[model samples]
Target: AQSVSQHNHHVILSEAASLELGCNYSYGGTVNLFWYVQYPGQHLQLLLKYFSGDPLVKGIKGFEAEFIKSKFSFNLRKPSVQWSDTAEYFCAARSTGFQKLVFGTGTRLLVSP
Candidate 1:
C-alpha cells in the first residue's frame, strides 16, 4: 500500500511571494502524482498531475510541480502568489493501474494582500 505525506501543515504569505509545498509518497512502483486545491467555499479542484513523460508538470494559475521518482517526491511550486491563491492544497498518489487514490492530510496556504 502507498501513503502520502505533506510536511507543511500551514503556510502564510503575502501577495507576490513565492510558494513551495513539499509532498512525498511511499511506493516503489509506478504511480500518478497530483495536487488538488480547495478554496474558501468551493469544491476540490485539480491543480496538476504527473503520470508519464514529463516530471515537471504545470497546473492552473501559475502552479507547477516536479515528480522525482527516485526520491518519491512531488513538490509543488509557484513563482508568485496572490491572495486569491490562499487555499488548502492536498497531495495525492494513485498507483499505476489502480483506481483508488491516497491523499496527504493537506497544507493550508494563507496569502494576504
Candidate 2:
C-alpha cells in the first residue's frame, strides 16, 4: 500500500523563525498531494495542495509546498512562522484512479513567542 511519511514528529521554534516540514510519499504514479493543518482544538483545514498544473503551490497563511515528481516529495515550507502557526501538520497523497487519501503520521509544531 502507498503511504506518506513526515520525518519530523515534533518541531519547536520561536516566532519569526523559518520552518520546513518534510513530506514524502511512496507511490510512483501520478498523485494528488495535500498539506493539512489542525490547530489545538480545531478541525483539520486544508493548508495547501498540488493536483498537477504547477509543481510549486502557494497556500493559506504563508504556507507553500513543492511537488517534485522525481523525488516523490511534497515538502512544506514557511519563510517565517508565527505563534499562531502552531498546529499539527499532515501530509496526504491520493494516487490517480484511487478514492482513498493516505495521510502521514503528522508533525506537531509548537511555536513560542
Candidate 3:
C-alpha cells in the first residue's frame, strides 16, 4: 500500500521569513494532493489542492504547491509567513478512483514575531 511521508517534524521561522515544507508520497497511479492547516483550536482548513489541469496549485493564504508526477511529491511553499501562519500542516494524498485520504505524519510550524 502507498503512504505519505513528511520528513520535517517541526519547523521554526521568523514572522517575515519564507516557509517551505516537504511532502512526498508513494503511489504508482494518478493521485490528488492536498495541504491542510489546523490552527490552535480550529478545525481543518484546506490550504491548497491539486486535482488536475496545472501541476502547480495555488492555495489560500499565499501558499502554493507543485505536483511532480515523476517524483511523487507535492511540496508546499510560502514566499513569506506570518505569526498567524503558525499551525500544524498536513500533507494528504488520495489516489484516483478511490475515496480514501492518506495523511502524512504532520509538520508543526512555529513562527516568532
Task: Specify the highest-TM-score model's number.
Answer: 1
Weakest 10 consecutive residues, lDDT, candidate 2?
64-73
Candidate 2 lDDT over 1-68, as tens digits, reads: 79999999999999999999999999977899999999999999999989889899999999999998
Over the stretch 1-113, how does candidate 1's per-residue lDDT look in tens digits?
Answer: 67999999999999999999999999867899999999999999999999999899999999999999888899999999999999999999998999999999999999999
**TM-scores, in order shown?**
0.97, 0.97, 0.97
lDDT for 75 in candidate 1 is: 100
Candidate with the larger lDDT of 2 and 3: 2
| lDDT of predicted model 3 | 0.93
Please give the ranking of all candidate structures by lDDT, highest first, separated by commas: 1, 2, 3
Stretches > 4 Å off in candidate 1? none
lDDT of each: 0.95, 0.95, 0.93
Q: What TM-score does prediction 3 earn?
A: 0.97
lDDT for model 1 comes to 0.95
Kindly give the stretch of ten consecutive residues in candidate 1 with the minimal lDDT sum: 24-33
Write model 3 residue lDDT over 2-108, tens digit each, in one string: 89999899999998898889999998778988999999999998999899999988999899999988888899999989999999999999988799999999999
